[model samples]
Target: MIKRYSKSMKKRDILVIAPQPFFIERGTPIAIDLLVRNLDNFGYSIDILAMPIGVSPNYDRIKIHRSLNYLNAKELKPGFTLKKIILEVGMVIKFITLMSKCNYRVVHAVEESIFWALLFRPVYKYLLVYDMDSSLVEQMVNRFRWLKSIENRLESIESYVCLKSDAVIAVCNSLADKAAKAGSKNIHLLTDVANLREQANIECKEDLNEISQNNKIALYVGNLEAYQGVTLLYEAARLLQQDKVEICIIIIGGSESDVQYYQNKVNGDGLKNLKFLGSRPVGMLEHYLMQADILLSPRIEGSNTPMKVFNYMASARPIIATDLNTHSQILNNERALLVPPSSVAFVNGIKKIIENEDYAQRLGSAAKEYVFREHGIDQFRRRLQIAYDTLK
Candidate 1:
């Protein structure tokens, strides 16, 4: 990791407690980088405490302080893990250490990290900002059967933080409504935006060239977590193969472990036509996107909008997404084909898009127009400023 912390910078007004790795090709980091950029524009000196995994974002006003990775591990994935539980304790200790060095006025924390910020609020007396990305309780219990014991207590803790935090900055309307249900009087909705262009140093078209253009390509770009609906997509792939559908569902992101695990599972099931390529750089995104006939955001769990939907809309590709609140908050019937998270539903949706070229093109065009008009860096910056303004 590149050390870029500078003592020359002025006093930091905010301490952004990001439990995820920073500057990585994933959801939370991308949003955090954007937050740093816009906060710099607004002249807020900030300190971000994150895991020791990701590369530096390299902004001037932002000084990054990573919590001790005691296990000497180099990478971390999304979701709740025992490793994360250990790291949270380290981060809380680090947060306490930083309180002695910097008198931060606001503490902006994402996900479950808000609990630590709240737990020590009386001592430090910082204005707490809960950056609600997703429902942490839902994320844990929906995925892991082992977390059933503490599920109710987890929900209670989420409600407690929402109620006590100085402000709640929700990522979507569904999350904002959730915060309201928990009695958070000061709630702000600051949604995510799309980064359409990639500053790619290396151009990659080797993988796309191998595929034949005989069948239409449907691309799914994101992590291969179960919550991301990769398993659902695997089932969809099988149904399509049985039905002799002529579309290819190309997966473009996952950790090495996830890729290997899913590939093994697919091989065991004898599923076909679902291609798995490990995570690609953000720069190669447009190159890969051009080869796609359709974009997908098939999240089976969580209410917050998937970060891919913004780019899916911005990519001008006809989208086929789950009809859950996760996608429907941003996508409607006219914008994209919203269907139930099922194999038959995906198969029919793919056929409908394939059969009607004009309709597909219209959906793509409408989505692009909507994304550019509503979800862009400008709006993200404006909403973020409004949230911070209240903290002042």
Candidate 2:
């Protein structure tokens, strides 16, 4: 464990709490990594307490306490089931025990872990900071109808945390508005940031000259969840079947089940143009992004403004996204090709891009410029610093 004593009497100690271990490729892990890396620049020292759910080997410098020996179960059958209740209680106990041994100026809990911090707020002698990345309430309500009771309880827990915490950081304006409605006085909108320097360092070694000459590749780099609209991409491919436009949709990063599900869908529907490359390492993601003619963000109505969108912007690739509030906030109609969340619209958008290469290039250039000016790591670090400094 790397230990450091407080040099100045006023230097605040910050503890970042999350369910997933740091350095993972997921959005939350990426956010944690950025926060940790910018700690010194923000004039604070951070100790992390992350669940061992998806522990990564890259986090050697940060002190981590593993908790909750729980299995990854997909189905949600009931609320307050005996086994789940026991697990939740046990995890909370372990978290509190570990927290008791450490002294910190602020307790920064991310996502659902804010519920645990709220439960132990009275005993914890520090300012609580709730860093809500997504609307858990909205997600729970959408995912499981039977968990309405549990969802209400979780919402109450979140509301309690927001009410009690010294400060709150939401990743988007919509979430920030929700936090404000929840009575959080010190809510700040901290948009997702791209580690552009690292992404730019990825060498584009793939010889895309031949591929680029024949076909226009539209890439979708994210999980294969239903809300992500992967099926719509397949339908869009079907729509443009005989247009004489050679277009390929490359999907990267999804689980085994996701791969099988999408594969079956595409094959069953006889869509040969959509290719599933499965999951790739973070280093390879940039290469794929670089090779693409356009990036697609076809998310359905949900609380997701994926961190990958920022990476897409950083790649400086022409983007075609659904005309949703989340996408509109980042890639306004001027910077990206805005289409409705439908197969026909997506197909038309791609056709538009293929027809006007100059417009596509202009949009790509403008999108990259916007991202660097607003959503770069330096901007993220500054916003975080301001939020931390505002904390009592």
Best-fitting candidate, scored by lDDT: 1
**Distance from true position, residue 218, model 2, in Å?**
0.4
What tens-digit string does per-residue lDDT give for candidate 1 at 1-392? 11222344334677899898786889988888888777777776678988877898767657899888898878887888888888888888888888888877788888889987898989988789999999988988986878899888888888989999989999999999989999998898888887667434557866553563457888999998888888878888898888888877889999999999988887898866788888988878877876788888888889899988888888889999999999999999999999998878888898899899999999999999998889887888888888877764
- C-alpha TM-scores of all predictions: 0.93, 0.87
- What value does the lDDT take at residue 40 in candidate 1? 70
The TM-score of predicted model 2 comes to: 0.87
Query: Which pairs clash inside model 1?
Result: none
Clashing pairs in 2: none
Q: Tell me, by TM-score, which candidate is best.
A: 1
lDDT of 2 by residue, 154-257 (tens): 77766777787788899988788778877989987898876656745555565443544456788999877777888888788888765656888878878877
| Residue 334 miss distance in model 2 (angstroms) | 0.9
